[model samples]
Target: MGSVTTTEQDLRARAEEVLSTLAGEDARLREDQWTAIEALVAQHRRALVVQRTGWGKSAVYFVATALLREQGAGPTVIVSPLLALMRNQIDAAIRAGIVAVTVNSANNDEWDAVYADIENGDVDVLLVSPERLNNPDFRDRVLPKLAASAGMLVVDEAHCVSDWGHDFRPDYRRLRTLIVELPSGIPVLATTATANDRVVTDVSEQLDLGTGEQTLVLRGSLDRESLRLAVVPLPTPARRLAWLASKLDEMPGAGIVYTLTVQAAEDVAEFLTERGFAVRSYSGKTAPDERLDAEADLLGNRVKALVATSALGMGFDKPDLGFVVHLGAPASPVAYYQQIGRAGRALERAEVVLLPGREDRDIWAYFASLAFPPEPLVRQTLGVLSDQPLSTASIETRVDLSRTRLEMLLKVLDADGAAKRVKGGWIATGVDWHYDAERHRRVAEARRTEQQAMLDYIATDECRLVFLRRQLDDPDPTPCGRCDTCTGTVWSDDVSADGEAAADERLSRPGVEVPPRKMWPSGMAELGVDVSGKIAAGELAGVGRAIGRLSDIGWGTRLRELLGSEDRPADDVPVPSDVLDAVVRVLAGWGWERRPVGVIGIGSRTRPHQLEHLARRIAEIGRLPLLGTLPPVGEKPGARENSAQRLAAVWGGLDTAALPDLSGVDGPVLLVDDVLDTGWTMTVAARAVRRAGAPEVLPLTLAVDG
Candidate 1:
């Protein structure tokens, strides 16, 4: 907003009016909130507010928006992350007579209307996601106009702007470009509750308007007096789940049960619901409508809790949220602090329980692997993208990266000026680009340090809040005297017998559906495979079955011991009897359209004995004939490789000639394997079996990657 000719008293009065409207008639502005408002509105200064979650960070912006618009400046532009956050912010804006509209991925149908409202000056605040800022159409058509005329800019969850932050997003790096292009004296306010000293400096640098003016940073303490932290270093996932099942009722109020992955969220929600608890799962995979319902349910206290991943972390506002229970520790203490901040916002007492499990480290490493790829991989990706535009699918054919990682790398390259995103796809800019190897290396090392700090948090015997707050560089962090360590743990270490029994039973249960791959990976022809489009209907593999996922709590725990990766690889021994029994149960429970007449093993270089043993046992138990082994005839890629690479490796890698005459078998054949990663091996192998004259194929696997 342009500098307003206003006195401090006048500005404070106006800000108080807005605050009262948003909160209540008796509501007053905190001194720090008033200071931020004055800096933005009266002096047109850029600012950063790093206060606690409920400390009126939003009030500063809302009040400034009212004053600026009242003084005839353009509407405020807010770059928020979550749809739930936007919804809540819009509602809060409306309370102060501010017309706010959001243009996110979920509301494409209403974008035109929203845009018209903005143009007509009928909207006071425009909320968008950071990704929307770089959309080809939006960036080309709308951003220039908005930057030319916006009053103020707000970056919610500002820590994400720094690559060193726990949730660094590449799209946020574009804020620098957006800021540089803004007109002089246009105020920018970046706010977050989770940033430490390093993130604060990084965000402050990004917030610099380059108008010979400095960013006014106001960082406050990161402690939450209302939160009582507790940590339970459970020995097993089953015990942790069991403890949750037992202690949930004793928890303070309606809250959240946090998980590290989508499958865990769904699994925990299902287990709790089966135990007659009112809970639903929320994750990045949940449908928007379902997320809305779940959010509404929790807001209304219609459910006891929502089992959610980090997707439900930032910007979710529920002042009276009673507690937050993390099933596993996050990779960093800073991130854990942010997630637990959701609780005790408006209450005097709320429980913050952490049930740290051994599997958390594995999950952390999986995410770590997705960090900025090595320079060689980056050079390869750049080599693939020439002057001609290639959609991400086309790029996948040439570069060996997963879809998620590929998208992230493309964004980084796009920001690095080595690639440009266009409507059709991405085009190489031919810039003399150099990968920031040093920076990324430091970031990676920082991640390891943060992960170890998290482990240390679990093992610490000192003040819990002090340990967490100190990670955020809080000034003089001291004991809160409210945590379990300071005030002895409230809950017992032992899980009730009944709760443990139910959880063990649930974890031990078998049979996860393994749907067949219908359409082949795009650009397979370019990869030298002729197969494309849907699998030939006559040759399609039927829906398959797996005893469990590698990430599952029950059979997964056991199966991992046998088929686990480098950490726990098993010797090529005979299949365990219990596992065989689980397979028997899975097969008996699977109501296939046609029962298999024979079983065939897909040979594994790593576990040939185990695969053959399981296949032979299944054939013997089912009273079916043992057909043959589909031996590997070519070099195969790692099981964790992307779909395109995996497919190319296994296209003709199987020796169909190894099989005996299958002409006599007319019914379904059980295509068995030790583990399924990308599912390409199974697809190619099953296609060969069907072509070998088997009428139908029922694929079975010991474990599937979650």
Candidate 2:
């Protein structure tokens, strides 16, 4: 509840006892580590000691334990989010000669033994995972049994509780609640290797500690000046591997090559192994023991390098890493910083190489696409998991997906701690229950867009360091005079195939009139044209179908063409080239006359000027349908739902009517449809429209299912 009653002499004596217990004469705490511990003991306050990786975060915990024990307090309970981390710290504690026992799921006997020892004042330190601590049974059955227990709650990797932190674990959210249930004023010490400003705030809020309450200690940015960061762009797959090989040759250190996929990791590792580079691969599928062995080999220099996915470095503390190579683009800067931070931990020179290009971008985009499951698929999955445990059959029956893809999706959910496998089926965890599918999808989309931006960044021939620094939100990025782009060593921006920078010249030349919304103000000026007659009604219906069809087709170039009509000459009005071309193509395919110009209207007879104008107007109407229709007679733009607007609405809900063969009407016209829930309705409409009077119809929609 408060600072240890142990005096400075008592602490020093206990420190000596801990060293003697560990049987190491020179294994003493560094000045910074000792000062941090003393500050914690003196004030009995919460503190944020941001020691860098390999800076002995674990050792500080032991120092606190010794001080607390010397004051005859109960055994200190250290809460961590990860069981692996708890075990790692316990191992380190044993090595440091601290008597510690872990109460985690992996070993029940050890857990009970530790609880009994703590209750009887037999153990000095008690380590438990946050998940174990949250278990109500543990608090009711095990925790209350501890004797004289008023020890501090030392939280490791506190960033996990912060929403803004990259790896947010929802279980951590209940930590504050759990702490409140514990002894009041139990000094809370939170530690992390990395904590940005937002993360720090999160820790403070969740722990109920104010800034003044938190003994703040910040080590300067651990940016290894010796670690050279380079982004290499390879347009194609073959070139990407070649670039990777070249970079690997340049470093040839005990490094790790991280990739976006397990297959990529395996392939890269195999390739390196074949090329006689000592390489071992690690991924989620790699057995835990095997992964640990591989990591140990890499850190111990037994394996020259490790080819891994992002799964390897959760709490890895390797300082001798000479390089951290990203085989593809990571999702965000936070990810990149964490991976790269693994290198140069010893303040030794290292390198962070990124072989990023179009192929890597494509792979990242593909993964991101998986992040956003279709709404129907998500709804179906949720429904299936409603009554029973979720299995492959349930998902397959509910969501139409291949076995391979479904398995990947399930794994992704599992990795994000959304659902956990139980009794051969997936059950939603607390984290999964709170899963906002749409929000996650939006995040995925945003990441994909950002990945594209990163690709653009890599492809650009600009000051690479400046670009990287700016992305990290660095305020004063004086160009690091070292990168290939900064020096004349390499070019940054690539020139177009034609040599000069891509042209931004006059795209629209004179002569052609850009299609206006109303080509025939006089021809069809009336808001409500007489639709009682078969020909007029049929024409209106056909135009409506064509308008609907346009929504489905890709409009990138068309949008540009519309916007491109800016500085064109008067008569040179760009003839809505894009929309006209679309209409002509549709008509030709539908076997229509596909007239060259004059009014392309559907009527028995019309004046030549009117015909030409109708053709133009049809194209214009395709762009913006309400142009020819008038608003309600008394309505203004602000308060108008005119006949034209109402007609457009009706068109969206129209049933295609049979038309009599009209003499003047000709071939295929572009038809726009919004979304294809099922292709049948549009198919039937196309047929009926063609049979009536229109020669042909090409129907398109915005999106369609396979």
Best by TM-score: 1
Score each candidate by Cα lDDT.
0.88, 0.54
C-alpha-based local distance difference test score of model 1 = 0.88
Per-residue alpha-carbon lDDT of model 1 for 1-706, expressed as tens digits?
Answer: 5664558778788789888999999999887888799899989999999998888888889999999999999999999988899999999999998989999898899988988888888889999999998899888888998999899999999998899888999888778889988999899999998988888888888787476777999888787879999898788888999999988999977999999988889989999999999999999999999999999999999999999999998889999999999998899998999999999888999999999887788789878878888889889999998778899988888888888888989987887678989999999998989878899899999999999999999999999999998899986657899988898865787988888888988888888899999988889889899988889977888899999888775666677778768666789998989999999999999998778889999998888888888999999999988899999986755544578778988888899888777767878899999888889889999888888888888899989987
Model 2, residue 136: displacement in angstroms? 6.0
Candidate 2 lDDT at 624 equals 27
Cα lDDT of model 2 by residue, 1-706, tens digit: 4565557657756666665554366666676666667766655666666555666677776877777676666777787765456667777778765678887766876665666667687777787776664355674567555412657778787777764565555556556655555555456678876666656776876666332354445443433455566676645434455455545666746888887777567666766676567889998788878877887798788877788887866567676788888877776665566677788776556767787643454345445444445656654555555334666644554455545556555544554545544554676654633456666665556565556557666666676555654444443456665556666564233433321211111111111111112111111123343222123323332322231111111232233233221232123233355445544444434333453221122211112233244344555644423111101122122211122323222332323332334334544544443233324334334444544555545443322321
Question: What range of 10 consecutive residues in model 1 has the weakest lDDT sum?
Answer: 634-643
Residue pairs of candidate 1 with colliding backbone atoms? 1-151, 507-554
- In angstroms, give how far residue 264 of model 1 lies from its true place: 1.3
Candidate 1 residue runs with Cα over 4 Å from true position? 1-6, 566-569, 638-640
The TM-score measured for candidate 1 stands at 0.97
Task: Judge candidate 1 at residue 183 and give its lDDT.
Answer: 94
* Segments in model 2 whose C-alpha atoms lie over 4 Å from true places: 1-35, 81-84, 103-105, 133-140, 143-150, 209-219, 246-249, 359-706
